[model samples]
Target: MTVPQSELQQIVSALQKSGLTVESVEDGALIQHGESRVALFAEADHQGGVIVRLHLDLDLYVEEDSLPDILMGMNLLNQGLDYGTLNLDPVDTDEEGEDSGVAFAVLGRSVLWLPDLGVAELDRLREHLRRFEAEVTDAMERTLHGSKGLSA
Candidate 1:
C-alpha cells in the first residue's frame, strides 16, 4: 500500500484505484469527483517528508460589496477545517474581460505530509474532501447566506 518515494505517479494510481477520475497535469494531479475538482501536488520537503497540497475550486464568485461577508465565511470555515482552508482569491469572472468587474473565487486548500496518508491508501485524503465540501456548503448556506458574492 505504500507508494514510491516522492513519485507522484503512484499517488495518481492510488486516486484512480479509489474510483476517482484523475489526470496528471503539468504541475500536479487533478481529481474529479462528481462536480467537484481537486488538484494535488506532492514533493519532498527539507524535513525528509513529502509535502502534500490539495486544492479545490469552489467557483463561488465574489462581489465588491459582499467581500466582507465572503471573508467572514472564509474565516469561519477555516476554523472547522482539519488541514484545509477556505480562501478568497482574485479571478477573472469574464474570460474575455467583457464587462465583469473585480471578482474573487472561493478556494479550498489543504496541506499534509506523505506519512499522513497512512499506508498511502488516501482514506484521510478522501475524508478531507468530503469534510471540506460539507463545511463549505453549510457555511455558504448559513454564514454567507444572502450575500451577493456567491452564485449557484
Candidate 2:
C-alpha cells in the first residue's frame, strides 16, 4: 500500500472546493475549465517552500519552420503576464513524426510560490485561478492575433 502526498492532496481538495474539475492523480491534479484543460503539480523547493505549477496545452498548432515567429510571439505574450510563460514545442503526431508539417502547440505554465501554502492560500487561489487562466488566454490571443481579448 502507498500513501498519497498530503500536500498535493490538500491542494486538490482546495481546488475542488473552488468548483474546479480537479482529479487527483499520483503526484498532481488535472483540471478542466471551460475549453481549457490544465494540469497542476506541487513540489518542495530547495528553500523549504513549495512550488505549485500549472500547465495547459493550447489548441493552436503551427509548423516547426515557424519557430522563430512562434518564439517571438510567445516572448511578447509572456512580457504582458504578471508571472507566467507561453512556450511552444514540437508535438509527436505519430510514431515516426511523419505526415505532419512540423506540428507544434503552445503550452502555458504558471507557478505559485509559497513558504506556507495551505488551506488559506488555496482559498485565495480559488478566486485567482479564474483571473489567471483568463489573463493567459487573453495575452496569448492579443500577442498571437493582435486582438485585445480580456484584461486581468
Candidate 3:
C-alpha cells in the first residue's frame, strides 16, 4: 500500500481473519503455524507500493559438522521449489561460547499496492508459507538420513 502504516493494519487483519494468529510487532506481524513461525514486516517501496517480507522459519536444525551437507540439500530443495529461497539462519549459541546449531529458512517477499491487497492475495501468501514449511521439513528429514535433499 502507498501508506505503509495503514496498509499494514489491513494485512494483519486479513491474516487474522484467515485463521492465523498474528501478533503486532514493532514494524509488522508475527505468525506461528504449528512448529513453524513467520515474521512479516511492511515497508514502503520507492514506487509508493508496500513491500511485505515473509521470513518463514522452519523447525529444521543441523549440527556443525553437517553444515556442508545440509547446505547442499537446502540448495537442491530450493531448485525444486516453485517459491521462496532457502538459506542458512543462525540460531542460539552453546554455553561454552561456541556456536550452536543452525536453522534453515525460506525468504519470500511480496510487493503490492493498496488496490491489490485482497483475499486472493492473502490466500496466495498463506499458501506460499505452507509450501515453504513443507519443503524445509522434507529437506531436513532427507538430509538427516544422508540423502541429497528432495528428488526433482
Give per-model TM-scores. 0.72, 0.78, 0.65
lDDT of 2: 0.72
Q: Can you rank all candidates by lDDT, best first? A: 2, 1, 3
Best by TM-score: 2
State the lDDT of candidate 1 residue by residue for 31-114, as single tens digits: 886677788888767766567788888767777668876677567667876656787778855466555567777787877766
Q: Which stretches of candidate 2 lie over 4 Å from their true place?
A: 1-5, 95-101, 143-152
lDDT of 2 by residue, 86-124 (tens): 777778775564555667777788888767666677766
Output the worst ten-in-a-row residue range by lDDT, candidate 3.
106-115
Tally clashing residue pairs in candidate 2. 0
Which residue pairs clash in candidate 1? Answer: none
Q: Give candidate 1 misplaced runs (Cα > 4 Å).
A: 1-6, 93-101, 116-121, 141-152
Candidate ranking (TM-score, best to worst): 2, 1, 3
lDDT, each prediction = 0.70, 0.72, 0.63
Candidate 3 achieves a global lDDT of: 0.63
Q: At residue 67, give the lDDT of candidate 1.
A: 82
RMSD of 3: 5.1
